[model samples]
Target: MTRALIADANLIKKVQAGEDPIGCVLCNQACLVEDVSNPIISCQLNPDAGYELEPTPKGFFQTRLKPTRLIKNSIVSIVGSGPAGMELAVSLAEAGFEVELFEKDRELGGALRRISNAGVGGVWCRSLTHYLARIENGRIKTFTDNEVLPDDIAQMAERGPLFLATGSVGSSCHSTMSGYHNWISSSDLLKSPLPAHQERVYVLDNKGDHESAWAVETAACFSDEVVLVTADPSPFSRLHKTGDLMPAISRARSLGVKFLTFTEMRAKGDSVEISKRFSPQRELVQDHMVIEVGARESSRLIEVDGNQTRQIFEIGDCFAPRTIQDAIREARCYSRALLELVAT
Candidate 1:
């Protein structure tokens, strides 16, 4: 409730005042657990959120980003335009680095772009990209729809430092049970909204996070019988870890979305099969299926080796798939490192 009020009511007041609200993302990551030990509790978007206090040991979260030593317009190549890459680009540019941003997609905002379509709280996810893009505008040179291949990394590194945040690829059980042709990712479904005529929709809650919940919510829009299948005993069980379990379940049930937990899906010849534990397996319908099983790091570009002349830093999901908070904070830390390195 407090987080919601700050993000909503307080944010509104700030906007009305014509102030840069900074838009509290309401992630509740920092303050939620800062008192336990070394305090890193601070806003992910705000670089100086905890500047008044002493710095922590630079864990998953980072704060107090200061690039006091300015560079002489040295070029820094940032690969992938996800939240992490965008944040790093803006951070480096602010520190006087000539930023060269690249994205394979047509636009910026890697996973957040697709995340925006998932369900509630999506608006902020999308806006975050816009916020970073706005800050980097005219400051960074962006190359969208341009993939930085493995071969291209060494070339870019030859010129300057490379920050690779190649993001990740979503996967589900459907990946192993291919050839059915109806299986699709929740993100892909959001990008290409499902047809209105769908009779039923099934979502594999492999993620058990907001994305999985978001998929079920999005699926409910087009199909009356939206079913969420999960291996966990309680569907969307992970939401409780972030203070959203009950709400997600309530919203999902209100939307007529059903749950099938402790269940597994299998490939039976040309068709897919599904059944709960200790239950008889039944052939599944050939309807559209949305999988929210999380993703693996996209590390194809990381295979190439770096040399003494140039340094290649893999940030965010490329380092290992994590939250947007981890992404932005890591970028902030790197930006500070970049300044210290090149300034000397």
Candidate 2:
């Protein structure tokens, strides 16, 4: 299936010929975000990949009109450098809005910077080279390591709309638990390598997303024993949308990883409390716990000093925790509308 995602007729020809071979970087963000029921597979990085025309109410096909670049001297301020903020900045710039982006981190790419360690060969992240180059050339003004606050938003949005793509923070739900010590955020996995030689590990999988799978899989490699704890009926249940679902599940089981399904963890006392849905609570101990059910929104409404066409928007994970595909698609959709708003 991974190989199937690599093939496209004309794309294959170009790849072989060493032309613009990266027509599809397989970022896996764009093509699959569409609802399975009403599927329209398109590339997140390249708008032309599968998005050119649309059907009208009269059942007639019409070319999707490009945003008309306005001559206004307006500037849009965007917070965060994650997928959503980066894409939105580029889209607004293309539509003739001057963009100023801010990121607290020294570099761009947000969570993807950490994800570079993964096996995807950096091809996908490199797809942003066009816009990243633009930053170097000063087409878009970027301020890395400069954190923007509500007051900053108030001031920036005075010129135009302000968008908060500030991404997310670790979930605080399980933090109040008594035995919540020695746990690492799921984000830790993306950021760095785990220490060697742990005796046992507990992987928390409440959200059942890719991070959960990664946590369990990583723990299995180093720890003597691994246990997956989830409140859902199954482990990595949300992974049915991706190709890694079955392989991850089967591999976990084969690697001596135990499943504690229909169970929830709150306290990490002498023995960790495992609250079961249908029965009495249980307890177990582990050397470390990886909380993969991460990300609470970090954005909040900024009280603009004055209303000078100052619109505020929250996109990507900040709007709500979601997949990279959702983050990109969300930004793209918002960009189209934002262009129209400023054009008028």
CA lDDT, every prediction?
0.66, 0.64
Error of 2 at 212 (Å): 2.5
Worst 10 residues of 2 by lDDT: 55-64
Return the TM-score for candidate 2, rounded to 2 decimals.
0.68
Q: Which tens-of-lDDT digit does each residue in 31-91 have in candidate 2?
A: 5644867686666565434544532121110111212232257677888887788878877
lDDT of 1 by residue, 118-214 (tens): 5555444645655564555547898898987777776776566677888765444335445556666654554454556567877877678777877
The CA lDDT at 16 in model 2 is: 77
Between which residue pairs do clashes occur in model 1? Answer: none
Give the candidate number with the greatest lDDT: 1
Q: Which candidate number would show the highest TM-score if scored against the true structure?
A: 1
The C-alpha stretches of model 1 lying farther than 4 A from their native spots are 1-23, 34-42, 46-72, 126-130, 133-138, 145-155, 171-181, 187-198, 221-224, 241-243, 277-290, 295-302, 306-310
